[model samples]
Target: MEKIRLRDIADALGLSVATVSNVLNGKDSKVSPATRIRVLEAVEGSGYLPERAEVLLGRNPSRMVGLVVNDHPEYSGHPLEDPYNARFISFLQRAAVRHGLELLVKTARTWEEAAQFASIWNMAG
Candidate 1:
């Protein structure tokens, strides 16, 4: 099915596109409570799902975080070897969860792959 547009809601409510946009984007502090409720009901009836990243960015605290670790001698070798990297990742995951953020760890197979992965995930050493 096709997605609904902000203009559609604006036209339906007899409001300007900018006003509808502000309400939908949750920057409606200047808008009246009745107008806010109308906008919310319109969104629900239209089955609109806001982008997760945008919503998270709008919140006081974000919900996304990333972690990356290069190859350490302690974490390399046989699977039975001491799982230092695994333990560290688990700890980081727990800490992130406690703070309401997600933790992602990725292992790169080569230096080139590692560089590419870092660029993709926006990580820096």
Candidate 2:
């Protein structure tokens, strides 16, 4: 089967391609909850992948920041479960937004895992 396009998703959902594009681009304020859920479901169920041009355009405006947290043994599998980590991340997120950056968070259970995640995402130090 051919890879799904934004137009194909829009046609299936009875929405304009721009609307679908905005939804996929994380502009949720422009879409209603019902429409947003429908679009999300359709995208997930159909396995939609944005084209390279679309991906580049989306990234061109801002930089992507990846936050990889290694869960501490005392934190029960997630460092964010502790208030300190949660608060720290919140501050980081605010700072990133203020600087016009996109934040991507992931849990890295070990040093190896963190390295793998960074390499996979092409993260900058």
Candidate 3:
């Protein structure tokens, strides 16, 4: 199914995107209560879910955590296919969720590859 975006909801309600954004972001003080209700109703009906990365990036440093698995191609191409890596990743995922973090997993054949992803994402420790 195609994803519904915030702009779609705003257009259907005949409201500006900014107004809809304000309502979704809990900054609805300037928006009329009736309009706020309408916007929310439309949003729920449309099933629009905002991107988590965008919301996290709004905060200082971001809430993104990267888990890089150093995989040896000699053993297997897929890092998560290994039982040990899978177990460790499962633990890390639970811990990250408990701390309100978004976990991004990457399997790198080389340290350089891992560093590249970490640098590009600016993943927090």
Q: Order of candidates by TM-score, top first? A: 3, 2, 1
lDDT for each residue of candidate 1 in 1-125, tens digit (9 for 90 to 100)? 77577777778888888887787655888999999778767765874444443344453654556664665555564322347766877888898889777776655445644533443332222
- TM-score attained by model 1: 0.41
Q: Which stretches of candidate 2 lie over 4 Å from their true place?
A: 1-62
What tens digits encode model 3's per-residue C-alpha lDDT throughout 1-125? 89788788888888899999988776889999899889867775775656763454565876779988887876568878888889999999999999999899998886656754664564677
lDDT of 2 at 64: 66
Tens-digit lDDT track for model 2 on 1-125?
A: 88788898899999999888777666779789999879878876886655543454455443767898877677788687778879988998998889877777888677655644444443333
Best by lDDT: 3
Looking at model 2, the pairs that clash are none
The candidate with the higher TM-score, 2 or 3, is: 3
Q: TM-score winner among the candidates?
A: 3
What TM-score quantifies how close candidate 2 is to the native fold? Answer: 0.48
- How many clashing pairs does model 3 include? 0
Steric collisions counted per model: 0, 0, 0
Residue 54, candidate 1: alpha-carbon lDDT: 35
